[model samples]
Target chain A: MKLKDIIAALDAEVVSAEDLEKEISGGYCGDFLSFVMAQAPAGCAWFTVMSNHNVAAVAALTEVGVTILCEGVEPDEQLKAKAVGRGLDLIVTAKPVFEAVKALDL
Target chain B: MSSLHLEFDVAGNNFVSAGSASDEVKKTLKMLGVDPVAVRKVAIAMYEGEINMVIHAGGGKASVDIDTDKVKIVLADEGPGIPDISLAMKDGYSTAPDAIRDLGFGAGMGLPNMKKYTDEMHIDSTVGVGTTVTMVVNLR
Candidate 1:
């Protein structure tokens, strides 16, 4: 599914500039940065409450197309900037992580 | 030279920039045309080491070398050294406080994860001194 479609379906707010048309094959949810990096599938929508800068790095290394910060978590500006720097997109939502993951319908 | 060297000084107690070195390593590998899987292994190994340095060792230095068939990573820290390498390497062993866990790390997975992704891993530590981890990822 296209990331833009997932964003719209989840009502997530984009925090960084990037192409939303990118396709993501699956989803993985984990707050542990190392686990996410080592195990997450590429092009997956990463759902997590962890909005730290390292999240962006994990997304990049795992080649996840976008990060969905859940549970009303807002991306810190530094995190947004870093995500942008790495060619990754960040979005936030008031929805719980499970709810957001369901929205992707992957 | 069979290896190309890169260095980064990791700042301890700085959660904000924990993965900087690893990200740089990933970018470097991509630029140098390394295999995609090898790049992933090197990035994950170095990143876990960097986070350990920041969360437990109060910061450290990371040195990496890229070669035709292997990528080598060495991380050194001056924090209170590991008392037991065997215990530390256990998949679920970690000494990090709750605060570190709250950040989504320190789940006793760092060292094991590092070893999991690399082709070869070694650890050297001195009590009341520091620790050094050397890892290699082979491209072939």
Candidate 2:
């Protein structure tokens, strides 16, 4: 799915507008950064409640299609700046974790 | 064979920049045209060490060397050293506080996962002094 499509599906806010057109293969839901680092696949959308600079760092390493912050989670200005530096796309959502997992797959 | 060497200073308790060094190393490996599979392995192993340095040790030094056939990482820290390397190596062992866990780490997977992804692993630690870990991931 395209990132924009997923954003619309989840009613998410675009935290990183540069990535609206990117392609995503699927989705992964995990709160643990280490677990996601070890297990997240390339080109997948990572759904998390984490709001930190390290999240962007992890997204860059995994090459995830996008990072969706669910449960109204928002990345602070610092992480937003870091995401810009790292070229990581982030989206904010009010949906619960289950909604994203049920609506997306890899 | 030719090689590249890089070093980073990991600040103890600085979670915001925990994996910056590993991220840089990943980019370097990619630019050098290392195999994608090998690069990912090195990234994971090195990133784990970076987190360990921040959470466990006060902060330390990380050195990475990528030669023709392998990537080697050395992490040294002056925090309270591991009293028992054997026990810490256990899959489900962890000493990180609840605060660290709240940030999505402290899962007891740091050293074990690092060892899992590397071709070679070594640890030297003193309870009163500190700890140093060396890991190598081969390209062949």
Candidate 3:
């Protein structure tokens, strides 16, 4: 599925890279970085409220297809730029973390 | 066999920088044509160890040696060491403070998960001096 679908499905806002909605995949959710590193499959949509540059780094390392920031938390401009430069689809959702994950049908 | 060695200094209490070492190791392994599964295993195992070093041990050093037969990781920290290795190895056993938990870590799975992902694991630690973890993931 395209990233646009994920945004539409979850009623999320496109926080960055409004032009790159073509990149999307299955959803994976976890707050624990270690657990996500271990279990989050490569090339999948990742949903978390982790609001740090490290989240973008993890997405780069894990090759996550996209990142959905839940709970309406907005990352700083640096992180947003990093996400865009890394070609990651970044979105923001006002819904709770679990609800965002559920909307993805993961 | 000539080994590829990589070293990283993990910063104390820096959750944002925790995975930097693992990320570099993963990239190096991938460039060297290590098996993808083995790379992932080593990445996860070493990443967890790095996080533990930051959270519990006040940061430390991580050294990884990659050879034809195995990838070896050594993480050494100078914080308060584990009093009971076996107890600490159990799942859901954590001594990390609640503050670390708010960052989505300190779940007590660091040691257990490290052991789970590596083929061989050894931990040497003193209560006050420091802790050293050595793990080997065989490359078949």
> Residue by residue across B53-74, what tens digits does model 1's lDDT show?
9988889999998888889899
lDDT by residue for model 2 (A1-106), tens: 8788888888888878576777888668898887887678888889999897778777887677889999998898888998776677888899888887677644
DockQ of each: 0.64, 0.60, 0.43
Candidate 3: regions farther than 4 A off: A15-26, A60-63, A76-82, A85-88
Candidate 2 falls in which docking quality class? medium
lDDT of 1: 0.84
- Alpha-carbon deviation at B16 in model 3, angstroms: 3.4
lDDT of 1 by residue, A46-82 (tens): 8899976767767776788778899989877778888
Q: What local lDDT score does residue B28 receive in model 3, on the 0 to 100 scale?
A: 93
Best by lDDT: 2
TM-score of each: 0.93, 0.92, 0.85
Q: Is candidate 1 or candidate 2 better by DockQ?
A: 1
Native contacts present in each candidate (fraction): 0.67, 0.56, 0.33
Error of 1 at B61 (Å): 1.9
Interface DockQ of candidate 1: 0.64
Per-residue lDDT of candidate 3, residues B1-140 (tens digit):
56888888999988767788998999899899998888888888888898888888889999999999999999999999999999999887888888777777776777888998899999999989999999999999
- Write candidate 3's Cα lDDT for A1-106 as tens digits: 7677777888887766545547566767877665666667876888898877767766776667778888898977767877777666688899987778777754
After TM-score superposition, the amount by which residue A49's alpha carbon in candidate 2 deviates from its true location, in angstroms, is 1.1
- Candidate 2 per-residue lDDT over residues B12-101, each given as its tens digit: 898887888998899899999999888888888888998898998889999999999899999999999999999998876899999888
